[model samples]
Target: MMRFHISYLACAAAIIGAALTAAPTAAAHQTTHQTRHQTTRLVFPGQSIQRAVDAAQPGDTVLVTPGTYRESVTVSTPGLTLRGTGRETVIEPGTTKAADSCAEHGNGICVLGTKDRDVEGVTVASLTVRNFTGTGVFAMATDGLTVRNVTAVNNGVWGIAQERSVRGLFVKNTARDNGDAGLFLANTIKEEAGAADTQGTVVEHNRLEGNRIGITVRRLRNLTVAENHLTGNCAGVFVVGDENKPRAGALTVRDNTVADNNKSCPATARLEALQGSGIVLTGTEDTLVTGNHVTGNAGTSSLSGGIVLFKSFVGTPGERNRITDNTLEGNAPADLVDTDTGHDNTFTGNACTASRPAGLC
Candidate 1:
């Protein structure tokens, strides 16, 4: 009787194993069907990148070869990838004016989606976009947009700019010598709006230098700026806010190297003269600044410091912000500063020598 019971148990185990194996087999068949439909279109030098992009369907990739192409690109399709061979695949301005709406707007590449719907699952990678009057790469109303391994240099405005986008990943890219921030994300650039929820957008593992600011997070929420190298800009990172509702905050700035942001920028119409700011946060709430290495940023500007909490221009003060666990040195005026009248702001566990109000280190 014991042998019969053991044999029955073995049979039950074999039945369960077979069922599990069969379920995966069916799933594999479905996955194969889905993967079979994705296509790749190649574009060479002297070819129209926009034409190839327009001809592509959803789940298509437009791969460009290593050459200099003088045209602008606009991508509106979901589940699309626009990848280049490497930095050798350069995009410059076209010969004539009004090449397209993107070129007409003075942008290198534009990923445009409507106000009502988001363009989802787009990827732009491995290219060099330079010398545009406007932004190198621009996006709006996008979901899950990934811009990786791209180089943006010497643009008149921002190197990489996005608005009304969520779930974005900007990684392993280089942005330098732009007029504005190397990477700029905002709720809206022209209009006044409340903060927009980014739904876990991440800017990580990039290098930003020689711009007005390294990275700017303006009026955004639920995002992270991490693990980037920022130098030679007027400011390393700027988390900007104003008197708008649903205020801009709830983001993380962590594990970055912010150094030597001492370039002088004249005052713009909306901003003060900028220099030597490592990480500046104004009019934010519930923000976390941690684990950063800030050094060699020295200037006498109003926003100058290793880490600062200055008064916002629009009368909204930072509240519930936490500055912790950072290493700061060689910053002028102070290594830490808090000049705003904010509530629930805390500074602890930082390795710094000087602070404006004292004891912040």
Candidate 2:
């Protein structure tokens, strides 16, 4: 396995133009009016966030005040808005242990949708979620789910994870110091449980740092990851397919800044073996990687590059994946690496300082 030590000196000059502050807290909504079908529930620090969640009816708003609340919150109700009124509103693992099901799933705040009761149209915003055993925010099998303007830090696994959900939005969030991918979106297509693939999922304007992967998309469709700052991680962005499912298509990774992602973490052999790269596409199809600043993600091996297109045993072959219109520079070993199994993947109109598998530039 290739071990990595995190460093940002190489990309110091590169990151000058990037945003350096936390996501704007003032953008948080003060109060939202209840709809005809919904009501609003208010809670304070002493009252558990989950208490309001349980008491909430469909389309209800659960607004929390500014304070630290140590608890594991799960949302099973649909059309609910669980929002923090202030930036200081925090949710940490209070009595929840790693042995619990919520902690095992790495979900500090989980939105689980069942066949009888799907948690659709749920919004969670303007909160800090940290020190949880699992993902800071986890949503599954929901439609029209929105998570915005939140900070997720120092979690055990993925910072924000969404699976088997459609039409979801994740914006203006900061995710750092996580064990796995900072933002992970995966759709599990299982016959027994009626799990379906996700579509129209948007991730934008987020800062992802110091994680195994800045952002990860697996087996998703019609997804967009744009305008995000990805730095100081093991790998910047990874888009791959699950071996058991059909490959993901219609994906876009655009207009993002990815730099200096070189951190060490424990992983499966295949993941651990991969070199540091700004973006990696394994067994994906019909994907676009464009208009991004990819720089200074250089590892010791030839595998480290600005962008990588490769075939893996875990999924389908990478075909028709376009790598275009990007500024790629200062990557070690080579700027671009494409393995033999990658077929019909094009690299055109890319402005790069260096490249491998020659002639792609």
Best by TM-score: 1
lDDT of 2 by residue, 27-117 (tens): 2222222446665554555666777788788878787766898888889888888887545889888763545466566578988898655
- Candidate 2: which stretches are off by over 4 Å? 1-38, 96-106, 115-117, 189-197, 242-245, 266-270, 273-275, 301-303
Q: After superposition, how far is residue 240 of candidate 1 from its true place, in Å?
A: 0.7
Q: Model 1 off-target regions past 4 Å?
A: 1-35
**CA RMSD of each candidate after superposition:** 12.3, 11.0
Candidate 2 C-alpha error for residue 213, in Å: 0.4
Report the C-alpha lDDT of model 1 over 1-361, residue by residue, as the tens digit.
Answer: 4453334334333422321111112111111012357755556565688888897888887777678999899999999999887798899999888647889889999999998999999999999999999999999999999999999999999999999999999999999999999999999988999999999999999999999999999999999999999999999999988778899999999999999999999999978999999999999999999999999898899899999997678878999999999999999889998998989999999999999998899
Question: What is each predicted model's overall lDDT from 0 to 1?
Answer: 0.88, 0.77
